[model samples]
Target: MSKGKEMEGEDEIEDLCRNDSKHGSKKRLVARVGGSSSGEPQDADYSVVASLSDELALILARVPRSEYWKFTFVNKRFFSLLKSGELYKIRKEIGVKECSVFMLASGETSWWAFDRQFRSCKKLPILPSDVCFQTGDKESVCAGTHLIVSGKEFEGVVIWRYEFAANKWFKGPNMINPRCLFASATCGTCAFVAGGIGMETNWKVLNSAEKYNPETKSWEPLPGMHRKRKLCSGFCMDNKFYVIGGTNEEGKGLTCAEVFDEKKNDWDLIPNMLKDSPVSTSQSPPLVAVVNNELYSLEASSNELKVYLKGSNSWKNLGPVPVKADVARGWGVAFKSLGDELLVIGASSNSYAGHGMTICTCFPKPQADELHWRSLDKGCTNQMSHFILNCSVMGA
Candidate 1:
C-alpha cells in the first residue's frame, strides 16, 4: 500500500518529535491504536503499537518540507494534537517568541505575524509594492498601523495601514522618493528610510534619510547615514540608529558601521565588524535585537549570534544557530527573538539557482553546547525573503 493508504487507519494522535542522530537527524511518531479495520487478531495489532515510542514522534516532527502540512491530515489524531497545537507546544517546550516575515509574493510584499509559541500566524494585508517603506531602526518601534513599501516599477511608493481592532489594511501617505532595495526602521513615532539606489543611470546610492510622521502624514528630513549605501541593514539600538555593513556602488562590501542619534540629530561611528582575517567583508546586516541592555548581531557567515553588552563594552558569544543554514549568497538576512529563543529568516538558492526563503528557530540551552537550529515547516511559498516581528497585539 502507498504511505497515505497505510496511515489511513491510525487513530488517537499522540506526540511526534524530531530526534538527533549520529548520521544526522531522524523522527519518531507515536499514536494510540484504534480498532483495526482489517479484522486482524488483537494480538497482531497489539504488537505493532507496542513498538511505538517517543523516537517515532521525534522523527515524525522532521517531516520533509514538502510533506509538512500534508502530514497534518494524516489522521484526525494528528490534526488535533500536532497540527493545531504544534506551534504552541514547540514554543512552550523551548520558550518561543512571536515574530513575522514580509515576503514579496505576487509582485508585492506582505507581512505574516506568527505566535511562534502557538504556531498560529495571521496574515497582515498591509502590502509592499513600489514604496520605500520598511521597519525602522528603532528596536522598540515597529511598523504599527502605518507603513509604506516601495516598488521597482516606475518609482511608485505604496503605503499600507493596519487597523488592529478590525484587522484590516487601509491607505496611508505616499513617499516622495520611490526607492527600491532600501533599508528602513522606526523610532519615536517616525519611520525612517535610507540607502537605496535610484532608478537613474547614475544609480545613485542614497545617503539621505527621510522620516514619516504617522500623526502628521508628512515626510521630513532626518540626519542621513554617514556612508552612502543600498541593500544595507539598519537597526535601532539604544534609541540610536546603527547602520551596518552593505555593498558599495560597484557592489563591494563595506567594513564601516555608523549610528544616528535622533536626540543629537547627528550620525556617529560605532564599532566596525571584522572577519577573523581582518579582510574587509560585507557581513549581511545582522537580524538584530536588544535584550537586557545588550545588542545582539546574528551573522549568517558565522552561524553565531554575538551580543554586545552595553555595560561591559564587549561581545558575548552566546551560541550558534540550531540547524545548518544555506542562505542565498547575496540576499539580506534578519534575526529576531520570539518569546525565549531566537528566530532567523533569510533567502537561499535552490537547485534551480532561484532564491527561496528559509525559517529556523533556536531553543535555549543551559550550556552553549546545547544550542540547536531547527528549520520550521515552511509551507509551499517562495523561500522566505525578508521578515519582521509585529507583537503589537500581544504586547497590548
Candidate 2:
C-alpha cells in the first residue's frame, strides 16, 4: 500500500473514534481504539455506570426508613443518597411511608419506640437532665418528622424535641404559659397547646392557647379559647384544631366543643360532644385522635371507639375496644392511630400481680362485624399502675 493511502485510512479511523465519543457510544470507540474486537479495553463504560447509580438511588428511596441506616454502609453513593433529603422527597412522591409508635413509659425518663416493620421495641436516648416526669398533664405530639414532648416538671413547663434523623433529643423553647393537662395538636410544622390548668397556686383551669414553631424553635401565643378547660382532648384534622370533652373552670365536665382555624386565627364553637354519648360526669376525659383525616374518640367509661362524622355532626359507635378479660376496663389506657392501625396500650387488671404492660392493635373493618383486635404484647401489667404520659405515631 502507498504511504499517502495508508495515512488517509488512519485519519478516517481517528475521525470515526471522535464521532463515537461525541455521540456517547463508548463500546464502538473501545473496539476501534484497540485495533481488534477480540481484545477490547476492559474499563467500565462510565456513562452507563452512572445511569445504573441513578436507578439504584430511586430504588433505595422506596425502602423502609427503619433499614435506611444500614443501607448507608453499602457504598459511598448509597450513603450520600440516604443522607440527602432527595430520598425522602421521592418516598413522599411515591406515597411510600411507614409509621412507628413512640411511647413514653410511665415513670421512665427514657422514651421507647416500637417499629411496626420489625415488631420490636428500642429505647431512645435519655432525657435531658433538667427534664423530669411530674404529676401533671404531659403530652407528646408528632410535628413533621420530630416528636415534641411537653409536661409539667419541678422546673416548670418544659418541652423537648426529638429528631429521628439525628437519633437524639434536644431541648426546645419553653412554653410561655406553663400549664398541664392541656389539649395539644400538631399541624404542619408547628404544634398547638390549649386550655389547661395553670401551674400556679390552685392549678386553675385556663383558657389560654399557644403554638410552637420548630423551625424557629419558638412558641407563639394563639387566641385563647372561649371556655377555660382542663384535661381537654385536642387533635388536628384538615388543618383545624379541635378541643373537646374537658372540665371547665368550675371543675365540671363540659359537653360543648370548639374548633380553631389556624389561617383565620379564630375559634368556632361546635355542638356538644356529650349530647349523643351522654358521658357521665364522673368519667375521665375522652381520648381523641385523628386517623386518615377523620376524628375518633374513645370514651373512658364504655371504652367504645366512636368516629366523628362532620357532615352529620354526630358520632358513630365502632364498637367496644377488645379489652382483655384480665385488663380492667378503662384503667390507665391510651389510644393512638399508627399508620393504618389503631393501637391501645394499657395495664391488665392483673397488673398488680407483676405483669409488665398490655399492648394491642385494632384493625377496623368496613363492616362492624368484621372489625377485630389483636394483642401485640401482654407481658407486663404492673406498669399499668403508673401513668402513661403520652403516645405518638411518627414516620421512621
Model 1, 131-223: lDDT tens digits are 333433211124433434443333334545543323455555555654555666655445777776764436787777777775566677777
Over 101-163, each residue of candidate 2 has an lDDT whose tens digit, in order, gives: 777666766777767632666678986644355445567877656788876567667777887
> Where in model 2 is the C-alpha error above 4 Å?
1-59, 75-96, 107-109, 130-137, 200-202, 278-283, 324-331, 348-356, 365-370, 377-387
Candidate models: Cα lDDT each:
0.48, 0.66
Q: Candidate 2, which ten residues in sequence have the lowest lDDT sum?
A: 46-55
Q: Find the 10 residues in a row with the least total lDDT in model 1.
A: 22-31
Give the clashing pairs for model 2: 137-181, 351-381, 355-380, 355-381, 355-382, 356-380, 356-381, 357-380, 357-381
lDDT of model 1 at position 322: 40
Q: How good is model 1 by TM-score?
A: 0.55
